[model samples]
Target: MATKGPEVVTDSKEIAEIYKEFSKFPSLSKASIGPEVISQYGGKYCNIYTEWSQRDLERAEWVKFCRQYIMFYDEDSIVYTGPSGNCTELQGELLTEESPSGIFKAVLRKHTNKKGEEKQFLEIWNKNSKEKSINLSGLDMHGKVYEDDQFGCLVWSHSETHILYIAEKKRPKTETFFQTKPQIDMTEEDEDSIKPEKQKPVKGDVFVYWEDWGEELVKKSTPVLCVLDIESNSISILEGIPDHISPGQAFWAPNDTGIIFVGWDHEPQRLGLQHCTNRKSGLYYVDLTGGNCEQLSSQAKAVWSPRLSPDKCRIVYFEGDVGGPHHRCSKLCMYDWYTKVTSTVVDIVNQPGEDGFTGIYSSALPQNCWAMDSQRVLIGTPQRSRKDLLVINITTRNVTSLTSGSDAGSWTLLSIHQDLMVVTWSSPNCPPSLKVGFLPAAGKEQRVTWVALNETKILPGINWKILTFTPPLEQKNPKFPAMNFEGILVTPSEREEGAPTPIIVWPHGGPHSVFTAEWMLYPVTLCRLGFAVLLINYRGSIGFGQNSVFSLPGNVGSQDVKDVQFAAEFVMKEEFINTSKVFIIGNSHGGFLASHLIGQYPEFYKACAMRNPVINIASELGATDIPDWCTVEAGFEYTTGQLPTPPLLEAMLSKSPISFASQVKSPVLLMLGEKDKRVPPAQGLEFYRALKARGVPVRLLWYPDNNHSLSKVDAEADGFMNITLWFIKYL
Candidate 1:
């Protein structure tokens, strides 16, 4: 019943056209997408002020207001272009400064917020007329002042000058700053100069952030608490943690005399600390107001993002099981200051696993990237077997499913403004867009309103339908025979609405990771572009029990790759899927599988795209930056324990895609972030060069400013844009 397959073409002419069309789609090199996220109140929701008599309250209004980047603009204004680009004018009263002669000013920039360019900036305003044209924020990476309203006119100036002018408070122009290299106090390098006496507080290290809170500001590089004084526009440091800590989640205590920060103190290699992990970490409070610090929690492993209630009555944080083989899955815990009692707030232990759909902890998240609010907690439950948005009841401990894992959608809580919550959602098929949802009262369904839809793509207009197919039963590993193996499939809603769609067999990146049916932009983008995406939860992925996840070590090559192959065969049998036009794409571990699939089954796929792929398994083992001590903790030797002595090396090499490069017949597109230290750019370059040398079709794209993950807005856009081109050409 399946649609007719494409005729096999061995002739060079067909392959030539495929390669040429792939090259025609202009590859994106620069950031074309705007800002994807914005935050207020540390990017979480919870109203603070019960009431405010003045326009700005220092603790409730001014302090919180000054902590974030605020946009300024006038309601009545025509768009104008300056020397640099289009601009908007804003005028507001100088809330912080004492200057009586308020100045008015205007600014210019794109209305759409892009990721890296989100820095606030300002220009100069004339003092005489209380008005000035906003100037372009040039090469200076420092924050600036843009607009001011005072007396009768508007004024504006850059924050770099450390000067303030008066202007109207309504839609006033202001400035934003940029990051510049800090001047280190290196004068003491002179051997003769008496070393400045190292000052030590009664207990902790004194940490300070110049503008933003971060650990990078410290000279000694110890884990210290970074604090900001909005009244004085100054920073302070409080140090006392056991080891060097990156500035994780931190906040000034209600007393304001002290602050609290969380960091890890454990064996780095055992827990993959190279990628930022803390084995033994807890909550500690330092009295900047001058008092002995106190330990708030025990030595339970923790993930950063900590939150304090408005009244400072309770502290909420994520707590991981201590000293376990599977410590990654943590639960949400809360501690009450008044009762002096600690308890598990959410029942993560009962959460269902991805494998047998049985309740068990795999992954519970409140990563530094997510936010929380007063009425409910917005938690990222990646282990719900899908990327889920879970709304937790603050008082009753009840959980509600907000958004189902759409495999095509991503939901993020940005900021909270009174009764409204601002969230962002995006997918491969959808341009990132903003949404506002009304905070549901206790025990009520949250009513959400979609706003500012990203107009960059048209995929959302098409409907998508779900498709399911059971993969053939896998022969259990000779070693781990108890493990279960299966795969999942998804199709666009458009298929039943009209015509059959092409197929894209997707393999998740982690040899130990599984792909969920949750909404994601990546696969959604392909489906929107007219392809049926089949994402498999191969043998090694989590959500399944321990046996399933641990099975990956010895099976990354044979069993793992077969899971993908079996998935392809299942979808190919579906009457609605076009079997002939399949393509494969993946990154990191998935990249390894994609490369291997193309080599092993070249005739099955039309093309492939790899992002920061791992080509040589053996090379990765020796060259990976992970600490040498990790070999024992990762259990690599144990997994390959039964291999015969002579063929051990060959077994590892056989799993590597690079070894079989000569067999690859499909066109390949590879991209890597220059700063990605995890799976370095060398991995992709090595494979690209190898395939090109053998006269196989290939293209390589490298991002200079990004890391293992493209966190920057522009870099992410460029990465996704290139992905679009690859599929448009080959599939």
Candidate 2:
């Protein structure tokens, strides 16, 4: 049986205290170290970075206080406090790009939510100008700019005369046909209405719906390849792009002869593009000399992030299979522009190397990822529980870990400029901060040391360590063998050995996504309140070899549930984990597991919390933006017109947490975003009603204005506070 639950309270002193303690950690939500700044002088280089600070988490407003910082990095220290520009994009995202010749830089501000005619701004910066103001705002354009990595590309031509980018195509004007004509009397100014026929009104375009890319890319419907001539102050939409395909990740061909981009096929259907790389997309090169467009990539279902080498001789990109598991280890291949030959630089790894290097779980490649030699590229990937940057020799196919094996933090390449690289490193206890490092002289990647750019937070009581957990070497599935997984344990250092303290098990969302070793607000907040947190990255998680990832399918509810339980039990035996006061919290798929933990093992947890969790797979199948996720996760391939059979649907229901809801006794706190398209709020309501009917303590928090992430300032802050209070009350 589960422990008794607490009554719903609007405010409490405990909530206030926890909120104040968690607020000390600054939120680096919109922070980034920018566009490749290669200006070096006397072993020192300059760069631009932006950070956003919220006014107050209590406010429901939708704006942020954004600040830009100019920093200089030298062999000794960094100058990070200089504020250079007052130009900030508070309402949208600011994207910057520097020209090859270093004479010009382009800045684009994408107004994300609004779809008005003028939704984006393109500005050019004259780097060599002597005037006080070197930023020149360019012509206003239609539709929001494509700032997303999957479809966004902003590059300047080699000729230094034009800029190429991708954005939502301009929507045609629509009006109701039943609308009345202008009531003004005819005059010389209105000769068109008097002497000629009135303009025809669109009959039904107002009610016609055009499907968007779904989820995070909701505003992005039809992408149009466009070019801007800064020298002539003219912008034109590029022709020759197929009408059935949506273009993105565009770049200029050598010498500005044409443009190369990835085109996603949207003819039959268009699925959500966010967090998914296995969509049906192909590489295409459009020739300006003859307006000819040709498919450059040979047979491939998905290809992404085609980055040209520094010499422009090779185009390197990531390729993956189509459908099913949204993300997996993809093949890294290089396209020789001159020879028109494609060769794999790195293939999928079934197992880890002797050095503990699993195959590349590439998130994405940086714009300037090439080293000075151009034969090498730096790829950032999840190395088990943490992120690691691997320096791969394109020619030799040899890989080296850029980060030391002992480091507990995650390292991501923010921007790479030739020999100098800008990286963001953070751990569970440390706040996210920028670090700069230089590429070592060939075979010396292990010797490279990073210089800290900004100030790092030092928490005296907070400490985190990575713990490896192994499963029994038995056959669950022969083709997909079992593998060892790891979990990150965060604890307060003040707690003595074998001391009694509450333990919280945090499983990451995305049955596919792993819990990275970065600073997370809620997990750390719980740890600060004297609770130990075990963030587990189970067997099927990325960075754990393709075989382990493949093992997840067909065994979703049983395999993943046991792995998390095994992780908790493994840690409890080794650490001073308080088993009696154990709790669980999760968002999305993590929520799915939390539900399973409490339902299947009712007496294990004192209380539980879930955010936008998938409760019933059968109910969510038709509503979720990724319907294919339903088919693939149930241990089957996703195919159009392949709805589940009755027995299959029953199997899916059995895999859902709702199937075991009647056995649940633990108090459940559900947080849902009403506007979420991924997992609708109804899923949470279903569980809420079931728990309520069973007389189990349950509360549902519904945020109307938020999305799947619950990223709004008030939603996140308040949600964390409520979760903390609930755990405290149960304890």
Candidate 3:
């Protein structure tokens, strides 16, 4: 650690100006690839929807317009000669799309009123008749529309008459006596004389170890599967789904007799689905007409992303350990409905190819993973340190990499039609953009064509280089076998000849999550502000392999901390880095690592910024939604729903950042979301008070309305500005 502190400069005006300049850069909000083909007026076309917003930190309106691209292709080639489509004001927020027959389209939209009430409805429209459309709102049947995740889909029946979706049933009404009590002979002056009767709060089910429920609408009510009849505008809740099962991502089974979905065995009063990966979940099939529900994954403890082949012969799903984190290695399995035999297509181990390149497929596969022929599946996997797009043949079980090159970066498969695949590609240097290409067939090489829906807004001549680094053997823990771990160094495109640039070490959240070479606004902003950013994908990060990710659970503080230190040392050796001005910033689990780094290496860093960090694991075990996180990460057996013992508490405290609070000498900033339930605001406050009592310079900024992701318009903008100013003053 540096012995001398830099001179402090508090210039609110300069900070405001820096924020104003960067707010002009456009950023991607959402992107969707439409169906492979849509028949309109006897013409076949493909549609792509993308939403973008100017980086406005002050204004809350993030999405304004939806840019649409209609692709017209000939038998020989696709035409890319002129402007293909136009932009329109987005109709509510497009939730899901279903174009079963290619002539008709069904879309779900989530609309919120000025009063803050939200409603989700389905719109069925004919491709040829723009004016003829049917609106089916769940409100008519006292059901509230809901979706499991951002990419959650709505499935249309084989005949395209009914849509299967997940929704919440209305809560029961309170008794009239609880609502109000009549007071006799009470005058205005006597209002204080009459005391209101106190009613004891209704106790709900207790959540032991689970993810934070946050403030999702579905959590407050009972979630159920609902089928909406487009012609009758009638909605029927699928019955016989056990009360403990919360079904989502429902798709119509072959022949339209039943629906297949991933269902979580939820304790309504105990748990909510936000950020939850450790729940007891499985793939299930529910008959629509007879209302019979069947568990399809009896052999696996947890399963997700179930896909039925178009031919309706086999089913594919991902299976993983329920005891481990949700992002652990997932095995691909196929179930034959006719033979009732379940076979593992791929095990949960990282398989090395002939070239010795080893990796694991992402645990959370895309909703549409099955190919048009149902013989291949597209998946995103972590290779080396970056995310790549790969396709796996179900029969041969051969995985082929469809993307390469240093800039290939991360690719998300949005929609695929027969031969054409629509995806979004992004990297540290390149902004995210939508692309179209033909799927690679066996023994054939295919090239994808990029489409420009919106112009990539360059930060006015700003350039950056993303370099990868691997730590030496000494950084590895002897307890675990040797594994590959890497970090990314992001340096500004232009530097004063030999001047050393200040650097910020960033560790991503989800100690189980990996930091890919994807386009992120925060690190890019820091680079543009003349700072080098190092993103360390320490031992516990996902995508490396099951062993690496599971390694951190039992050795959180020590192993992860060393990985970061090694990364810093490796970067410091570079002549262009200012070791004296090094700072640290992280969120959630990343924040946990940052806190540990500052404490363990008190003299090494100049300043530290933590966003919703886990300060005291002992206290967190009781209040956090994921209490199991504490037990599992502490190297203890998975024991949630049980009270913590003295020994367990001791183990958690030993690994907590609070254990090192007394040694922290660097000025720290705590960015907390008041509404955050994951690492409750209390955790930050505990550390803040401790640092203040120790006479250390510390500041805490709380966003009252924001949750874990402080990415809300105003909160995100303000956070960026505050961190920049904090680093400017201290480093």
Candidate 4:
């Protein structure tokens, strides 16, 4: 870390100026990587990723204009002019998937948004792929297209004759109950009824109830498997899927004979599907010719992401329990298609070995992760403060760490073509950059090589290092063995003996989500402001082994909270930290800890800020989209139709940060998204109102149009700047 020289800001207003300057920093992203199609298009492979939009948009402009450079790049770093696809022209591109033969690309793009409807167009293009945008209501399509990670993945068949996707089924038309039915009556003069007599209507089932997948998938329900015939432009809503399960992550089966997908169970009730791999789901193969829906994986256990090898003889997937930490280190299991057998290739690592391969903390495997040999697959997972790439050979069960240890920052497999692989790497100081490389020998993936696509700009004067900590041995749970966790300490370029820098203790949202030390805008901007940031990976965080993750379920408020508190204690002892100006920040579960910390250790923190935080579990249970989360994380197995008992309520309240509100003295800032369904906006409101009642210095910022993430460029800008200002004021 740098020992000393950047300028310091004594005024909070200076943060706004810094925000505008940082806003000029270009936004770059690289995705949809593929091998060179025609020799003419130079480079080992091709990729599509977006660039920038100023954070200075007016509120109305936020809705009117959203811009980002969704450009294409190859070895030359030039705009894509290839015949396979042209993504640079489209805006709001949702999902892009390549065909098995790599002859074409299918892209989904948002078009317009009329009241109660979301308009989008689907295109399959190299040069002449048609762009079709139709009013879903005109086509009798019910809900908007499923373009999210949960239940929607666009897929193309091997024959290239059809494409398959998921969309919400049109709900049953309803009316108020008790409405009279139309009746036929004979006319007095003709003695024959020419028309049905109008009947007086009283009521109908207009207010009838139906449930949807909460949070990000709130409007999605009862998804139908849609197959589109390419040549005829006709769609077939395949009907063999069990009505009890909602299908997602679908892919075309071998020879395009059937479709393989993960079917999430909505039998009892649908729960939130975002950021959760533990939902009860099964791997199913649905035959296109016969509509035969066959359960390919164990029906009772939760399974997801079934990737068929390039050779088409085998499949690999993740297996976990029905519920717990929404995501954890899961067993990677593979199945032989011909033999109809399944085996655990990488069994769950209860505790990582000293070498540190801590099972698989799956997000989603790349669509093109297969190597040329078809025996190995590449996937990325968080390892301590960094994200590591690993190659897993299903046949041999040998796992190779492509980018191991915290020093590498993070490695994401974009796509692999023939034997050439495309991966993106980014660290605390560097922005994400695309690179082309080749996979190493089978068990020897320990060594790797790469050629950068373009030079990446580094965050000026920024430096960082990974700091490790362990749970107090006496307080550690015996069941959860791997107690050591890590944090990324980001310091400004310069250090001075007399000027100890203010440090922010930042924790992640998942409680299970690992805080990767990558190039994120907010943390980097904070570092540019001369603040040291400690991004924590608490005990229950994923990527550190299942034992570490399973440790926090029944122990949330206490263990996770103490971990943050102890982290601060660990950092405060450092020579360059300003103990008098220590502050904390968290979002979601991280917020839960921040609130607890301020209250539990009243005099320690100078101030605190949280976004869409969980304030009161007891109150949040009835409002949150993921009530299952409330029950499971509170040490109870969620059962459908189970109401909270007095004991459950008591336990939840005791575990909530709200209980400690009275003891809090530090000023607080709450950044909330009104549309957030995961952790309802009310959660933050509850805290804001409490702090108000107690006369604690508090400020609440409402982003009415944003969701749980406050992901809109404007909202993100608003929140980031305010957070900096809040801390600046105190410092």
Candidate 5:
């Protein structure tokens, strides 16, 4: 006879306390340190930079009080606080030397009222000038000027008269028509009141493929490039842009004669912007005076990170087949304006390190990639599950690794000014911190200096160690070569020697995504709860070379499953791990793996917890925003409009977790986000129904307002508490 799991328990006070403790664990959200905006004043190379810190968790929400710190740094490392005291949010900042009094800064500010309503305004400040501050609040352009994650820039023209930026604007309202019939024997007043008013139907896009359409901005508003005249405080929308194109990453062309930007066609059937590498986008240039738009990369399927050479003779950009897999290889192309020719400077293909490439430059490369000489660019690429900085010589097509070794964590190249390179460095055991490094001149080796350490609340009784293991050769799938995979083993620091501890196996989503040695809240919390947490980066995960990442496309369930089982088995060999008390947790694709593990190896795990897992590929194909995900992962070529045929659906079903549902014997907890477009709520409900129909122990916890990330503070807190309880009850 099957045994039922313990009844679901809810302790609101305990959950609140856990959330309070988790809030103190700070994570760096944003950092601004780059060469283009670094101010050189009074014989000191200084810059105005800002960092957003996760300060406090909202009591009733899943977000945090992201406190902003705007500071000024000089060559001597003296930090001066700026005017961030009254602002609830720092929207954007632009620095320019065109002002008569040294350098001036234009910053956008957002203030939240007691009622939680937000109002934004623009402020111009010059410390040395008599007009220390000027507020441009009344000159509203109907949308926000700030776009997060390196998508848009608030920039000043070379002449400094006008500021250019991207802002959302309301779509034009459509006219409505209606017909009315006269009322019988109605008086004049009655007839006047009975007149029918035109009814306008609500208009909105279905967003079939565009899942990440309106994040952090107003819905139904179109993003448009606009120019603001500082002197007159008047805004003018840039003209000549086609209605079917939405512009981003806009900046002034050389000499401020025009604007150069990357634009995506407004295809209703196009995939979401989060999967931008799969979208057909192009680089375009529009003259400021004539407002004539010209397509720059017409021959390329997708173009991004377009930058003009300092000499103004050439333009360099990345071009790739957007229809390829998520981590598609891209070619660095240089266009010579003088010769009217274009050539590939370097082809970034996937291969083993030291001789071959890992992946394309990060999508956020434009923010801090250019070198002083303009002939070299600094980029970050995934190498064996860690992000490494690479210097690519555009002139010679040479790629040099600046940071690589056992201590390899993740490095973000922020800015290169003169010989100084600014970066954010972090490892599995270390939190992200800002660092200053030397930009090697010619053949000099690179070195770094720590600038600021991130504030972290260390849990008194928790500890973690990084580990790697090679599965037995016999366990490897014939189709995919065996490679050593990596994982982090987190455990309570004060456990008795040789004492058995419950183990939680965690697999990351995006079979293409790798688990970096970054600070994650959930894993740390699990470790604090006296459980050994194993975060595995199996085959097909990024950070490895192209071969390893592409190896699992046609073998998702089989190869990936074998790798996870091998990892779990290898870890279980340790006498300190209680094999009988083992549990598993996963999100998205990771959840897919967890479901498969519990089903295929039914007796191996005591319980399973999945968050927005992909249950059935066949059903997911019609509902998921990334339908191409199903086809591509199933070993089929990715296509935009192709619907799954009967045979293809069968193949997908055969590869899905639902195929092995009947074999699952462990209790399951399904945490689903109702608004998740990536893996719809139905995916979780489907798995729940399957387990329930079989009388397997099951429970469903749904967050109605959260999205796929489940990152909202409330949902995240709830999920952590529920999962902890579920594991404790069943493991």
Candidate 6:
């Protein structure tokens, strides 16, 4: 690591100004600081965490805008899009039901071929018989489809065929919007009526997470709830209130009489409460019978999986602050209509404490962590150290220990189904496995089976084992503090008996996020291709507590790059890794850190890949719509410190990776999204031009329609495929 720079000011304001100037320069270059300067200045940790964590929005309630996985089932099979955009996979296959509950089943899958044309498919599955592939590619589906009460009837937002809010009903056997737009016939009123205004076609998934009542609205292109009418053999749109809201989690009152959904309010035309700034929303009652809506509540925060009881009288959800650390305690709250009480189900589990942020310094996450029955609710609270999972009962206010004495860094709840729970577990020394346990009628939960990922044929020839490492220590509070740096190593499934394998060091995005042993698909795919992958849990990553998380800001680019280098070195010294071909790649903030490595320690890596890197930090600060505390928390303002235009310009210029473009000799592949509002297009273009000017081997790939991160099926898949190919050819 580079030695500390010159002694600087200790006064808060003057030090802030110095930092402003300091950040402008390339990240603390060893060559840039002179001894004379070093003698004049010293450095200290800025206590940004306490202030930043205080700004942590409640972990619950529905925030106006957050993205989540939206999936639909066909037959008995469940399908979902890959988080990395490889392609939608058939998660679980469902057998054909002899006496089907519904007439026909439709599967929604996104398809992207070699040429990269994006399209959505609605595969119609036959319940009575088996068919090779239910191809609905030719069908023109403009909006969303919902199941109505009618047996064969379905509702849709088919903008192409039907006018806005015009619900089209069709027979179960009939293809609704698949063929043509819904055309309204001529009438006396039609003669004088004006055509509706033209707007862009609705694209992508139709869900936005909102509060339980479907009242909070975050505007997503995907629709959250699907309204079905099974008896009519036809369907129509369940159109969310305030038109244009993207629904996230939904809860329907028992009897399925009244539906409550969480979404953003994009339009203010509807008669319900309207939310702002894409925050979590609350309580909207849609009378399925009357086709009307009622505003139930108004709250904001990200609410996870709001569930209704069998009787549908009570709603339960996990709520947290948007700005809070992801590993902090999130509350399980229950809402009752009869009592008009919104009370905490369990005494705010995972409070602000050491074990709460589990993982090496708290990069572990506690989300989608709840289950419920008629009598009580169960919440999975990550215990201090993250080695065990606690099952807490909301009704009795009692806590039961589930898995104990496990390695703190190795165990996590994977999925909860009915009475069965699936977990992905590991330790520094044990490979991860899928462990299944059943809820017991008496005493503790029952341990049933432990299935290693190798037992499945999902991906052939891939063998994964657990890795353990101790986080490097700090002078103060050295005992595995939150956000410490430790690295995990992954080896290829098909490897020579004793030959060293290629290594690709990867830093997860979200300087706040960590690498979990959660059966990652991309890394496994890389392993399948005969490469060793190193996932480093760097400082500033979440799941660790406030102090470790605080270390990331102002210095994330510098410190995280060191962690990457350290991981690479660790691999080189280990028996399995090929020291000659070490490569590094990352997305988002990870992308920025990648570039930092090439400029800062160009010799450590053979080649590097960066996706949506933030090269021009100052430019991003000016362009972002971030809240105030976030800006201060990021050390942007403190670093820049009210400098005049020229000094500020110099400061920004010094930090821009473009400033060191000429020094970077390693080849680089740049991937950028055209519509990325978070890290604008120029961040990529500036670096590309600079590298090209220096005659460095660099290539730029642009996705015209994606924003921030590549989410579309084609773009996401192509990104991984191309990046892998790049690694194969260059690393």
TM-score per candidate, chains pooled: 0.60, 0.89, 0.87, 0.89, 0.83, 0.59
Which stretches of candidate 2 lie above 4 Å from their native place? 1-45, 48-93, 110-119, 127-141, 182-199, 473-477, 496-499
Summarize candidate 3's per-residue lDDT along 205-283 as a digit string, tens digits.
2332333244343243456777878777777778888777667767888788898888776563344345455567888
- C-alpha RMSD by candidate, in order: 13.6, 5.3, 6.9, 4.9, 7.1, 18.3
Worst 10 residues of 6 by lDDT: 46-55
| lDDT tens digits, residue span 1-731, model 5 | 33222221245465456556655654444444423335555433334344444534555532223333343545424344333443253333332222322256555556666988666655566655433333433445455554454355677676667777777653333322343345367566775675232223224432223223532321423678888787877778898997777788787777888998888775655455563465678888899899899888864487777766655677788787766466545677887766867888877555655564565635656454667677777777666656788877877787777776424567777656554566667665455665555565555434433444334334566566657767677756565554667777777666555557788999889877777766677886566556788898897777665566667787888888888888888889963688888999999999999999999999999999999999898899988767778888988887657867888998899999999999999999999988887888999999999999999999999898888888877787778888888887874
- The RMSD (Cα, Å) of candidate 4 is 4.9
The per-candidate count of clashes, in order, stands at 88, 0, 5, 15, 7, 108
Error of 2 at 249 (Å): 1.2
In model 3, residue pairs whose N, Cα or C atoms come closer than 3 Å (at least 3 residues apart or on different chains), thus clashing, are 1-603, 1-604, 210-625, 210-626, 463-493
11-32 per-residue lDDT for model 2 (tens digits): 5676666665656555444334
Per-residue lDDT for 549-573 in model 1, tens only? 5455655667778777876776677
Model 2: how far residue 576 lies from native, Å = 1.1
List the global CA lDDT of all models.
0.49, 0.79, 0.71, 0.78, 0.69, 0.49
Task: Measure candidate 6: CA RMSD.
Answer: 18.3
lDDT of 5 at 476: 67
Q: Which residue segments of model 3 deviate by more than 4 Å?
A: 1-45, 51-58, 81-83, 110-120, 128-140, 148-152, 176-221, 267-272, 351-358, 361-363, 445-475
